[model samples]
Target: MKNLKQLELLEDVLENSSIILPITINGKRRSEIEVAKDTSKNEIIALAKEATSKWLEEKSIIKEIYVPNKLVNLVVK
Candidate 1:
């Protein structure tokens, strides 16, 4: 049986755990990135770019960021 202390610890861990957000490029789902729950828009975008950097071309650039949808659009030449 789980004790109250164990439950509280589990809850704390979950509260601070990172979340996986889907990354979209050109309106298409390309990959997913993990970030903290309290991560800001800019931080999320940076993480997404880093996660998808290999797939992105040298000329690729972030054109839009939809934080609510956890999506980032990249324009690749």
Candidate 2:
């Protein structure tokens, strides 16, 4: 978010590439004891499942951007 111009340019390109993002909790783990102390590992995974659904919901907005129809590979060295 520090570079607004870069984010705008990225919005122009890439588009829906990151439809599913990496699970990241930046702050103090939201008191893990409450989140999943008594639950099974499967229950712990449920949190991520819910987050994915939320990400998908937000991804819909980005999908409507005006972008080129064809794909062009960038030459990276």
Candidate 3:
């Protein structure tokens, strides 16, 4: 299984009010989606997972990362 460090990092970033969603196309990152600070972690993760799954179905890929205050960084890929 892939190591999803973002699960742990989400806890830290949730308090900081920002979440990073990196969208990749054909193994290359194309853009990033940022969640506002007021967004709930569960909501963010659910949305990200849905988006990632949809991207995978479309032959693309996406990974969600949560960086909190630049102190800790976690990635889903």
Candidate 4:
């Protein structure tokens, strides 16, 4: 779950910006995924799940995810 600060930031972006591709990080690797501003919350979650799939085999689960400055920080366990 996002903290208050992260929720606020995400809300700001969702309300004020156009579609974008955010940077996603997993461990030391990073990638980008395009997401439309009008995208549904479920879709966003699905995308995140897909992005983090490679780490699941290692028994990792997503710990945190936030869009800061349009960059997606996806931390895993």
lDDT of each: 0.76, 0.34, 0.50, 0.61
Candidate 2 has its poorest 10 consecutive residues by lDDT at 66-75
Tens-digit lDDT string for candidate 1 (4-53): 88999999999998888888777778889777788888888787888788
In the range 1-77, model 2's lDDT, one tens digit per residue, is: 66998998888666534222123232112211123223444544444445434333434221111112221111111
- Of models 2 and 3, which has the larger TM-score? 3
Span of 10 residues, lowest total lDDT, candidate 1: 62-71
Candidate 2: misplaced stretches above 4 Å? 1-34, 56-77
In the range 1-77, model 3's lDDT, one tens digit per residue, is 23467766776676776656664444455455577656665666565555556444534224444443221112333
Clashing pairs in 3: 17-37
Point out where model 3 deviates above 4 Å.
1-20, 23-34, 55-65, 68-77
TM-score of every prediction relative to native: 0.67, 0.25, 0.33, 0.48
Clash counts per candidate, in order, are 0, 0, 1, 0
User: Which pairs, if any, clash in model 1?
Assistant: none
Q: Cα deviation in Å at residue 51, candidate 4? A: 2.9
Residue 21's C-alpha lDDT in candidate 4? Answer: 48
Error of 2 at 48 (Å): 2.0
- Best candidate per lDDT, number? 1
Question: Which one wins by TM-score: 1 or 2?
Answer: 1
